[model samples]
Target chain A: MQLTNRSKQVSNKEMTMAEKMYLPSIVQGLAITIKHFFMKKPTIQYPEVKRYLGPVFRGHHVLKRDEQGRERCTACGLCAVACPAEAISMVAAERKKGEENLYREEKYAAVYEINMLRCIFCGLCEEACPKQAVYLRHDRMVPVFLERDDIVYGKDKLVERLDDRYVRMNSEVKATPTEPSLTKAAT
Target chain B: MDLTVLLVKGLIILVIFGITLLIATYSTYAERKVAAFLQDRLGPNRAGPFGLLQPIADAGKMFFKEDFIPAQASKWLFILGPCLAMLTALMSSAVIPFGDSIRLAWDGTNYDIPMQAIEINIGVLYIFGVVSLGVYGIMVGGWASNNKFSLLGAIRAASQNISYEIALGLSLIAILMMTGSLSLRAIVNEQATFFEWNVFTQPLGFIIFLTCAFAECNRTPFDLPECETELVGGYHTEYSSMKLGFYLFAEYINMFVSSAFISSLYFGGYHYPFMNAVHDGLTGSLGEIAGHNIATAIGTVVFFAKIFFFIFFFMWVRWTIPRFRYDQLMNLGWKSLIPLSILNVVVTGAGLLYDIKYTTWLIVVVMVVLALTSNARAPKSQAAPQRA
Candidate 1:
């Protein structure tokens, strides 16, 4: 085990009478403050301005649909398995012969829920999804909630529209690039 | 005619008051900016012109802030603290000599006016009295908060003030020895030549006075009350929004007042080089000229310039140094500085007896030595540094 002696130990110690008065030390501190008076300020003016973001920035979540305007999730339980917070839940339904257009495949989610309260929004579920269905977008999706319950977003909230016009507008990730599939899915 | 003069004087006072309030506001901005720079970080640059408009923005923020009053706090005392702090901060500026006097011309006649709002003969005493009273602001605020930390902070502030007040008064007694006048204006006039500033005559006294002033103001290196680490916002912990803002504002104002006092006392308040000559020159040129009023006005400007420079210096010192421990702070004030100041007086008295010139440098050197010697700290048994 590491020793607590390191915590108590003061390295590089030798102080003069002048250092003890603390005047010169204080002066050194002042020099730094004085130096900052002329330094460049980093402030992004809000509303009228926005800072640029990198690729794969997961800001806000949106649902994605296929070219035929079908929901992308296969309801194979991939996203729910990946979610660390246990935020994603779904009731899978077996597609009948006449229900081919309702889902991308034979399985469809009869009920889907994402507990926004439990979700830390780390986007692990988005990474875990084998079907490239879930995505966490950049920017503060919304301001931190006024009510505790307001944070828990559900089925109507989580899905993204995978349409050509919608994908064109949100192609570039503003904060962090999550994965290569996000770009392909957008395309 | 007197009524007209009164009206004019009132206008000038109003203008000066406005300007001082404005300065106080901006000084807060400067304090933050300085702190930011010292820490190698950017501070408040959002409002306008590299945060030039920050004071106004801050004022807006304060006005709109949640004025929190703790349920446990004494309601009357809670309100009383910031009120006293703000009032006392503004009151001292009234006696401040802003610039040289200006002539108020009506038709063919011009009347000479004192640049200051009031020119009391006992200006120095009045200032000392007022500043000493400034302690009540912190004391009342801290006590009313009803928290143990707040009460502890108040106690610290009260004791600190009590200690430094003595040193401040004693240091000035030495300067009073040389100037022989309590009138601030007179003191400045006596040091009209740039070379004859009191800092040269009584450098030891000046250092002592300055050190004591910093202590009195509870500035860093002596700031025991709001020692953020241990106290957790100290006396003003419960104060939210504008109330806390006022307490913070008072600190800057205290710095400003100390700067003014220092400039007036030692650096020659409002007195400029060749001021007497300039007065004579102008009078000769104008045939009775605009006269002494103009000279006084010039002196006033010079005085304020010096004060602001010191204010800037105060901010500089604040950003530079960490605070002293309570024990160390008390020890320095009572033990080292007090004895050194007494020694300074004794030395100054002898030098005066001998009628020596340039002995001020000797005082400065001695003070430097004494300060250095006292700072000869003992070896620490506990290698860990505790929060001051």
Candidate 2:
């Protein structure tokens, strides 16, 4: 009839003379506290200092730019489909004539948004993006925002502001690691 | 007293009062810092660099806070309580000698300015009387609150202070028996060196006095009245704003005064090891005027160092030990500490009469054995709780 056999019997054991005196135990406790008093305090100043996040840390999403200074997203809608929280949404637009400098492809997202409140930062969107446009950047993370609307990150907040040459150099190095001469020539 | 003496005395009184107040204010900061350190965390560092201006910020906050009074509370008595607490706390410092007489040159002649506010004859008795009166503040504040918790806390505080006072007086009697004087100055003079300190002679008595002191101060381990778990802020539950600040300030002031008292009574006051030799050596090298002043300064520094150490120890114990249950506290006060202190008085008397140096050791040994055996033979109700 017993629900569980986990309960142990409580012992009403008698205390020894030393234990009864209470002085020894108090002294022992005092010694321990003093030891801690001299021990190195492990306090992080926080804002001025930060703990090193691991390499695999998944942070806020970044809508990346290609080496040619054009947006990488082709409005494939894969990232939105992969977003488990349904946080990502976008309005696909057709590229107008002479808009080749702005859009990398004929199809581009005119209005893209991610509701940060709903995002779990699981990096699934990054993995689902075929164009390598959406990435969880290691350098930047979600900032604390007061309003719910403020946390909804737009392309203006998410896009990288690196120079075109730096982007070209970085992409050349990452893409053609086997061809050192090509990367050097690209840089 | 002449005008010069009166002015000097006035100056000393003002300086001591300011220092006591400053120390009490900063002790709140120190308490948090120490507590934080013990728990491996950083305490308030935002007010100013290292939180140095925390007390000033706190004072400002308290001043601006809305002063609340319960509708059912007795307003006048509630106000009187903290004032009485603070007054009694500061009054004890009047009898405590801060340092030996400082040689001052004025009007083409030198004068010796004793570092006490008032050199009262009955220093010990004055301290006892003031301490006993302190309970009235807590009781009045609690009763005036018109709250059940406050009333309960006040009753607990009243009973605790009264019970501990007996043990406290008895323990002091042991020291008085040895010193043969009621004056704190006399007690200090008796123990003019480290070895002569009453702490060595009356270890058991010191232990008893210290335990009772914790109770008297309403510090942790004996802070049953204000214990958060049971009483919910205790006597000061209904208090708010500057009134609450006053109660807290009074507690720290009491702690500061008690530290000085303990140091004066048992730790040889301003006396250090080889103090006389150092003074004589200084005088032998430097001229008497400068040498004497320097020695006094050193002694003053040493006295303050001892007081700070005791204050730190008080905080250390507070963080280390948990509060005692009400009944256990009562039992320890009435049954154990009182009887032990009584025995301590008798033994100290007998030892002093015999003029035996080893008698203290004998008494200490006896005390240890008696305590252990007594606890072993104690009833089940009084059996020691298992330590965590």
Best by lDDT: 2
The lDDT values for all models are 0.76, 0.84
> How many residue pairs collide in each prediction?
35, 0
lDDT of 1 by residue, B229-306 (tens): 999977787788888888888887778878888998889888777877988987787656466666666776777788
The prediction achieving the highest DockQ against the true structure is: 2
RMSD of each: 6.2, 5.7
Best of the candidates, TM-score: 2
Evaluate residue A80 in candidate 2 and report its C-alpha lDDT on the 0 to 100 scale: 93
How well does candidate 2 match the true structure in TM-score terms? 0.88
lDDT of 2: 0.84
> Which ranges in model 2 have alpha carbons more than 4 Å from their true place?
A1-11, A76-89, A115-124, A145-152, A163-187, B106-109, B369-388
lDDT per residue for candidate 1 within A50-126, as digits (tens), equals 77564455566655576676777888888888788888788988888877776787887777787777777777777
